[model samples]
Target: MKHCGKGVFLRPMSCDIKGVENLSVGDGTLIPKGCTFYCTRAELRIGKKVIFGPKPTIITGDHRIDIVGKHIIDVTDAEKLPDQDAPVVIEDGCWIGANVTILKGVTIGKGSVIAAGAVVTRSCDPYSIIGGIPAKLIKMRFTPEQIKEHEKILNER
Candidate 1:
């Protein structure tokens, strides 16, 4: 919650955010209840006008596995075995459906639609319709010609 822009609505007592200062939400974004964002070691950025449905989890860090002789959970020294982390970016005008899990180092492209219950493990192209366990491109939201027209109309507004 470092840079919350105007008209953003983050419901109280519903969403969980660790490392609050490492996150930023852009203008007009609506984060519904039951969202969890962990930004312990990297930035988590959500661009303008983005909508996130309930129970969406965005993680920027993972448990340390490189520490020898101890399980990832059993590592006691924080300085010796730091968690691996990376930035997660969700670009403008995207729709992230409920129960979605967005992992570290993923940049969801502008205006993309992530289907519910999908696990986004990689980046997607702009305006794509993405779904499945390891989210894949189902289709583009519009044809190339339509996209041009849409962008023109949007710019005009």
Candidate 2:
């Protein structure tokens, strides 16, 4: 596996990371096998204590399917098209489940939990639990009072 900088942990038989640069991993992070983290033309800023389950695909590009009618082409031709790339940011302390697909331009907030096989299409809020095909906010990780307490602690640090 290709490492851009220090602090990235790759398990045995993990896929290589291409086009990634200027990356920093905090202490106690674990990236499992068969997971592909591609950061082409984008910066993937992951924080401390993040955990990635196996076979999680984090993609930073999506193709434009804006070809109007009558220009219909074969499936192979469509696959050769260039994708519009964007940055994918997963904040600190997120627990991403296995086989999860995180699409382009998505920012998963800190302390969020993403369930397995979920397809995240949009940004998720901090301390939220998300799951399903198109990932939805299932619940908050903390109560309002708990959140306030955490924020207070963070502010003091």
Clashes found in each candidate (C-alpha, N, C closer than 3 A)? 0, 0
Model 1 vs. true fold: TM: 0.92
Q: List candidate 1 stretches off by more than 4 Å.
A: 74-83
- The TM-scores, one per candidate, come to 0.92, 0.76
Screening candidate 1 with a backbone cut-off below 3 angstroms (N, C-alpha, C), the clashing residue pairs are none
Q: Evaluate residue 88 in candidate 1 and report its C-alpha lDDT on the 0 to 100 scale.
A: 95
Candidate 2 per-residue C-alpha lDDT over 79-109 given as tens digits, one digit per residue, 9 for 90 to 100: 5345466678888789999999998789999
Clashing pairs in 2: none
lDDT of 1: 0.90
Local lDDT at 93 for model 2: 83
Instruction: Give the Cα error of residue 123 in candidate 2, in Å.
Output: 0.5
Residues 1-157 of candidate 1 have per-residue lDDT tens digits of: 6899999999859888899999999999999989999986789999999998889999987776676687867864364334367899999999999999999989999899999999999999999999999999999999989989988998998
* lDDT of model 1, residue 114: 100
